[model samples]
Target: MIDSHEELGAELAEKVAAAGDLEALKASGAFDELMEQIDAGRLQIDGKDGFLNLMIKAVLERGLQTELSEHLGYEKGDPAARLLPNSRNGSYPKTVASTVGDVGLAIPRDRAGTFTPQLVPRGSRRTGGLDDMIISLYAGGMTIRDIEHHLESTIGTELSRETISKITDDVLEEVMAWQSRPLDPIYPILYLDAIVVKIRDGHQVKNKAAHIAVGVDLDGVKRVLGIWIQASEGAKFWAGVCAELANRGVKDVLIACCDGLTGFPEAIQATWANTTVQTCVVHLVRASMRFVAYGDRKKVAACLRNIYTAPTIEAALTAREEFAAGEWGQKYPAALKTWENAWERFIPFLAFPPALRKVIYTTNAIESLNYQLRKIIKNRGHFPNDQAAVKLLWLAICNIEDKRARERQKTRTTDKESSGNHLVEGAATAGWIQALGVLSITYPERLEPYLS
Candidate 1:
């Protein structure tokens, strides 16, 4: 038992040593002293009135004093103070809320009354980081009221809903700018989808579709083209959406993937005549399974997989005939008809090479994005207006993209393997090289011009 305990302790020490810079800190003795203080109960590293809050208080006071010294051109107790008319006027007590807690600060003043501390500005009751925290919580799907209660429970800081809303509202201008920004001239693939969100229309709450367009550029980075809110969708509405994209600098889209919606293909063709409209095969499979009995779903899915997985369109057609003749197909005629109706749109992807075919047929890129968006808006029972919904959605997208960027940065700096935190947006599409090569060969005339 003694030997086992010794071996365990040594193994844990070895792992800690190999962890990272923390090993160097442990070697420096500073971390050891901190741990000693913590063990002795002389330091409390957590809670509202802890070591961190004390450090924050010290830093802010030190910063304010430094600013005052710089402004008056001398140290607080320096003999040079006699030469200047402006002298130290002591400090006034002010309590400000921070991420740690409420920190009481002795805000230094000048005899001249001209000094202003930029670190913690006058009349500001919360640190900049506190506002950032509020915005982050809001982006994470917390309502203003929820955030208010959270801060109060965590840090004993009470904030009004109006104040929280104002802080979140700062992102609205950014949302507008992003919505109106220019897009790439050419997108190799575009995925169109909508998520239903409830919004108040006058006296009653109505469900609205917030349409999203995710475009994969030639470089394989997924980009959100724009978002649109509509009560209902049709050929005319989609045409306007396409036209809006065109107006925002999208010159061409090679292929647009969407679920089977009436006149949707027509709308895409009207805008970009050469663009191939591909129906989402996953949606087709799901629709087929809707009418199937639960016990037979797996079997039915297995049988229908033969059609989509077929090598060629003709083979797919033959497979479809086989499925139509099968027992499940006979039992559920509507299941087969769903495929038959979408056959024209579904078969376009069958002609592509295997790699490109996989990329085109899989709607996982947009489906993942919609899944995230839905989770974000799920708690917000309803929005007041379209802009409110868009504002929240845009912030959520920014949060997702920001996290991916930071993870990539950390991986690069640490010289460690990727965290595997790849997101569809701002990251290369999976198997993009093989897919791009096939696309280049398939549509050299249209694709090659934009490749360079």
Candidate 2:
């Protein structure tokens, strides 16, 4: 036993030394040779300590050497290397912590100290995989402190909160890129909603609204187009948001469903003159119930439902009048006024066929997204600034979308006929086909051009 252990230690030391010997590694073609052996069943990678570590070492060293070659404008043995003022200055050992384990890398250096390798950047203690893990945890609503504890408990890595925060901060650039990405020329439906969050502005923490716009494409797939932050929303603010969407290539929105957003209809009309602004029936009901007594909520909701569920615009108006004159409406006049306030937007919902009504009657699509988002941000009591808030929200959105994609992929494997547009928990807009048919007929000129 003692002799076998000694031999193992010696083999390990040799492999460690071999990792730093870049010249010998290159001349031997060790990576390709090892791969060939593995392919031929002469050697194996069993996720063990020595060989896997050696494999990681060889790959990192080779990559660094290639980067150095590119930087110097010559290969290792090329006669053209001598013409350049800079050359390889050997390598230093670096142990990068990856998901598999800690990998000892032979980071190459240049004579002029100008070869900054990007594969595993200089001074980086861990690989990009570790950073990605941290970002994923952060996106899943783990606070920096929680992530620190999680890494320590799981991987035995004691990363500082600041370090974890910096890792997550790298997502800001991606957020900016995603925010400015172009959209489709037209959307069959758009769901607009706002989620209020606390953000510190200067010295004082104040409430702010993060407005999200979700556009449903011709294929019935919903994607969050963009997120805009504002201290408060107004006609000018909403108009700016609409203009940004328009500039991002949204030529028109056939039907935009939203909660009672002040001046949102005007903003939509300003951007797309023919865009139909539909108030969310669920939101209107909830708004009316805001002033109603808790005990009267059920009765009030049923009464208000009659207004929104009426057969036609004329019937809806009559139902609204009946509700206002009814005892419950007179008892809760504010609830009645809520319906009166959104009557123009509400009538559009009445005009749509039942199949299309189910899609446009509410902003449930965006609301479900916001529900997940709230869970992510709930741990964050308040963001330091708007940018910080946007960054975290964007990461959370990415995490949500990724989970949905995985679900769709899984569903595709099992049920080949399933459309990939399903959201979380296999929930999607039912009757999208019928809804789309209605939309095409209603706006034939605008909708048909894109269908082709």
Candidate 3:
């Protein structure tokens, strides 16, 4: 409420919110300020105002009173209150929508009833809460009727289907704006993958692929760059997706760790010639396992591990030769064949230290994101259109990003390091930093510009 979520003002909310609860807030020397506000004929709090609800309600009521004061050219307790031709007409009951729930507002009045308040004007059903509630439920993949019923059941307030749809449509503008927003010049690493879901296309139901891009910044923090909905996963559509990312200002991508999508590497190179393509080694390993018998899958995986775990590409090739010559490799010939075919792209990460190799060898960033996206839309029957698919996935992305941010905060200097690595401290991203250090040494020229 201080200002629209602004430039570097993300930190503003936390600073403003540091006031704690009413008791602790009052104890923070706000009592004097509260008294001053009361003297101005504004700022009232009831015992029921648990957190900011009282403050929010008081803010609305206080705004109406001030508007009335301005209209009458007098203060509430001043002699002008009586001297004024029109006097205070008390207040009226009205419910204003708020994020927590609905809040009943006492709208201040003038004797002549000439004053029309602006915050919650006459015949207005919408408020902050209604809009927020609609967006929240809609983002959770709720249907319009579902949201309408939920609001009615929870808050005893009913909104029409049209009203619900209209409220949710507000996000389309935001989504478009976000999709077109300028991105950082460089993303150290990007993980690209897709999720397929059914979408209603005219009369028939068709499967559509929603390609998702997750970027890891110069720092280890991950961000989902964009979501693209297409008829299906194909190299042509993926090229267009890469083009869109380039248009959005992603000029340089150091390494793109992705699934073994045929045209994916080519699509990335179309935008960034210098970008190294690291086809996810973990993907190759998993696909290799599928070719092996279930019982011997573990045995094949153990044998194949030597190639990926080798100290250098030469060492990896040597291990590959040994695995290909081994009994397990002979039993599961297809597993070694899969590794051999993708060996060129697979060995790119092996040249670097294990720290960096661990990060770039898998598409875990977007893979994990896709897994969460699938979970959110699992109960959904089918997306109505491409836009609906985009909207739902975007909402799911927002939530997943928030959870990651919280986890980043909760990540202390005392966490365990990695699968095969130990730690200097508990910091969750210690392994990422260690990997970045290796990247700096391996590609000093490419990484120097982004290094602070």
Screening candidate 3 with a backbone cut-off below 3 angstroms (N, C-alpha, C), the clashing residue pairs are: 413-426, 413-427, 414-426, 415-426
The predictions' CA RMSDs to the true structure, in order, are 7.7, 6.9, 9.8
| Number of colliding residue pairs in model 3 | 4
* Candidate 3: residue 448 Cα off by (Å): 2.0
Off by over 4 Å in 1: 1-34, 409-427
Off by over 4 Å in 2: 1-91, 107-119, 413-428
- Per-residue lDDT of candidate 1, residues 85-194 (tens digit): 99999889999998978987899999889998998887899998898899889888999889999999988788889988988898787778888988888999998888
Total clashing residue pairs per candidate? Answer: 0, 0, 4
lDDT by residue for model 2 (1-452), tens: 42443334334434545656766655657645555655765453433354555556656677777788888888888887788788888878778776545766668888888888898876788877788888888888888889888777765566778888888887777678778988889988988888989999888999999988888888776888888899975667878888999999999899988878778898889999999999898898888888999999998888888887888999888888898788997899998888898888888877878989889988888899999999999999999999988988877887787677576676554332422222322234568899999999899999888898
Best by TM-score: 1
Worst 10 residues of 1 by lDDT: 415-424
Which candidate should be chosen as best, given lDDT against the real structure? 1
What digit string (tens of lDDT, one per residue) describes model 3 on residues 1-452? 33322211222222224554567656676655556644664433222232244455656676777788888888788875776679888888987655545667788888898988887888775676668768767766677778888877765566789988777676787778767878778888888888899999999989988888877776676767788888888877878887888888888888998887777788889889998999997788888888888888777788788888899899999999999888987877888888888888888888777778778889876777777778778878898899988887876677566555546556444232331111111112348878788878877888887786
Superposition error at 92 for model 1 (Å): 1.9
Using Cα atoms with residue i matched to residue i, what is each candidate's TM-score against the true structure?
0.86, 0.79, 0.78
